[model samples]
Target chain A: MPLPMTSNQVLDREFLEIRAKILDLAASFDRLDRADGSVVGDPRQSLVQEALSVLSSTQKDRAEQIQLLFSHHYEDDWQEKFNLPSAAKLRTRST
Target chain B: MYYFDPHIHMVSRTTDDYEMLAKMGCVGLSEPAFWAGFDRGSAESFRDYFRQLTEVEPKRAAQYGIQHYTWLCINAKEAENVSLSREVIAIIPDFLDCHNVLGIGEIGLNKNTKNEAIIFTEHLELAVRYNQQILIHTPHLEDKYQGTRMILDMLCDDSRIDRGRVLVDHVEEHTVRHVLDEGFWAGMTLYPTTKCTPQRACDIIEMYGSERLMANSAGDWGPSKPTAIPDLILEMRRRGHPESLIRKIVYENPLEFFRQSQGFTFKSPDADDASTINDRTASEPK
Candidate 1:
């Protein structure tokens, strides 16, 4: 019996929750920066920074872009490695 | 508002959960074979699990008026044990004829290991030999993208596979486009955390449109919500999407994919009920 709500109504209903999540994320970053040692040039930190930059992008497909950014690069012979009977070790990436 | 959950692990759930599902207008669901939280010891264990899928779970779901369909496989985690995995695969055909048994699935890469890939290919061969639909589970978290890539590559490489009959589940923004572009059905799993949320699913629906797409709770033993499909419906409704569009994604789309399987024979609950007799059915305008 309920009618479909408008987009503004949806945003109004979700605004506080979204704001709280943003604050939580900001607080976590603040806590991280306040810690003793710095993760300045660490690849993981760089990935996070890249992900944040993706979040600020104007692209409509930012989600896909960010997901691809965090994903493994396509290897032409990716399946060939599976031919080895032995279990694979995790592939370490420098970039 | 009737819906079908295309992928959920009801064996890990309770009768109370079934009651809740039926109460939420979930008329049907399909349970794909997956890891039982730990590595099952042997092929005999998989046989027992298959029996539960084909026999026990169907009766249990029937108690709540939910039509339960299932898939058969050793699951990717246990596929690490090649000897036991082969043993289990040999015995899977024994239950393929079970009325509730749909096909081979939740069969995919857990850690993207070589052993997992070998076993996944073997499962595909089995499904192809028997002419069954496939339900795939891509890896989670960090491994998701690569695992999905590997899965799609393998599936596409197999010329025996009919992409329309296959469902690649747990697809996200980066992976879903490829899955759909390759002509396979895609399922977005709605989890409370970790996997896709209702909001993200709504976005996917908006971007992808309703064709060959569906959503499921993926409610398993872990931190999952069994009523997540209804939650998706609520989210879709909240976004001002039409009821028809919402119903297509949550209900009709799943039915379209599931009907391709020889084992899927779903009876509408509305057929006997006086409720919504005036409403048009999903498939035919009556």
Candidate 2:
């Protein structure tokens, strides 16, 4: 899994791209803040805020942490929540 | 540059799509069984589908000088029917002897539903018993992260499963790292929408480096381009990546993973008789 480019080389190549993304994110947050209605009580918004915090953290596994933040927790009876049929009903007769 | 698309659904595509793929340097491709635009009624439907994958598609691909390999499974979206899923699983072994049959997959969770998990595990058991290589489809968009986690957990729980033989495909920036860290091959899918674009895929290649990583178009009956691997090659070249590195990701990596499957006997486009397709059966397709 050796990279073709050195760390400094990659950083030099992608620096602007990274900076632009951060700026874009900041602008998005600003836009959200400027909107009339608030999403303060929304779980998705909270997750987004938490993800931003994770990105700012000193930990090396920020991607993994953020992924888990948005993931569904394992549930044993998740099928009970959905009214999906246990057996498939024929949708179309193959021509 | 010659490349292999490790995952695509050619059953939903036309001969023109195959010609376009061959024209654009797709030397070979693998089509994992996928949802047929709708739920199929019986196990007989899957049997017919398997026949098409093993019999018809290869000849169709051969006409355009493209080698077609395939995986067999009842896709996750259809796996909600636990009874039908079991029926499909039972009949899968009947086609495993086919020359082009790669393994059991494109099988993974859709909504991370319990029924999907049950059927996913059942497919795993079938793969282990038969010693077939696996190709997985992690869920799309919003469900990807969670579904990928569940798929990984299921694979890890089975000690009989060989991590090296399994390919967890459709990985994005968020899930790619974990798939590679766990010693399984990762596939990034290129699409016009929903999955990674060529630019994003190239960025991933830079960040992750290419060991057990590869890319595919996943082009099916959707808003996708079958020529996407070439686009990835073009992107890599544009980013100043060496031809050798680009080839490793697009060509060598897929061959390496596929070599583990007993069914894969691919001849490179550079070979003397590369135009000649192997594994052609004298008996007509059933």
Candidate 3:
């Protein structure tokens, strides 16, 4: 059987993954901004928008996954103690 | 070369786009009510929007000799506001009898949230209650597969929905088979990006065959080409696909579907010509 990973190792891996995604998302935004400045109009803008949506969605999914992981591994009362609002509450407030 | 764009958003397009579409042999198009680039403040805003769709847009399209038909709904993005969506849904019936109105549509999941699902079903209920045809907007990207499955499942659960009269738009390769196999009409949106391009759409046609399938530009407020359907035509012709098959996807198929709507009274421009009578008789099987 494989050895269990230390929490720091897990955090490092996750942070690396998230950092890469953030860079990708930033690159996508940059491409969109460049496309906006160009004269190609519809096609370029659309291509960049599609790329941005995909990257942004990936970023959101990763963030959510990390949140779930953190919630599971941390103490049960950790959220209440930290005054961190529940996911449902956050969604309601935003909406 | 005459065609019909089964789905488009003329409300977001300028009059110049209408002229260009008409020039490119577009005889008619249907605009499904969707988000106006931002969340609307109230049901009254939707009321005015519907008025513009039913009243002003047709006149605009008429100037270019293009017939404009519309489908009404609170699009899934804004449907997250359940109380506002309910208010908007309540007002949809007011426009159903309008001459240019087609049915309740462009209604489906956005984020596939619980509230969105609730409003989707409520919209379905309204469509069923009124015997209206439906046009669905499946979510984009990663959400598309799951959202489409949920929409299809909900549709399957409701026997009242005639799968034939409903169209599930924005289908990609992964989801098209399911939509078609389930007996609902499918629409492939030809976009510059983010959706199927002309080449990909042609490939889909080759794989799926043309029965109960169509394509649209989905020209709206975003970065979209209103004339993307012509690009598909060119691509199909370049591939040596027969003109008849091309005509079926762009024209006859849309006619066949839109004919189900009581409000659709489209007459072909060639209806008065004697030479096309035989052509019409031959293609009527579609």
Candidate closest to the true structure, highest DockQ: 1
lDDT of 2 by residue, B1-286 (tens): 8899999888888889988998888988999999888899999999999999998999888877788899999999999999999999999999999998889888998987878988998898799889999999999755888788778877776677889999999997678988999999999998875567787677678778999999999988877788889999998898688999999999999999999989998888788764454335324464
Runs in model 3 lying further than 4 Å from the true structure: A1-95, B273-286
Clashing pairs in 1: none
Pairs in steric clash, model 2: none
Report the C-alpha lDDT of model 1 over B20-138, residue by residue, as the tens digit: 99899998999999999988877898889999999888877776778899999988888889999999999999999999888999899988888888899889889988999999999
Q: Which candidate gets the maximum lDDT versus the true structure?
A: 1
The C-alpha local distance difference test score for the whole of candidate 2 amounts to 0.81
Candidate 3 per-residue lDDT over residues B77-153, each given as its tens digit = 99999999999999999999999888999999887777787788889889998999999998875577767777887
lDDT of 2 by residue, A1-95 (tens): 99999999999878645643543344345445544698879999788878887344544444334445545565433434544322211112211
Candidate order by lDDT, decreasing, is 1, 2, 3
lDDT of 3 at B183: 100
Winner by lDDT between candidate 2 and candidate 1: 1
CAPRI category for model 1: incorrect
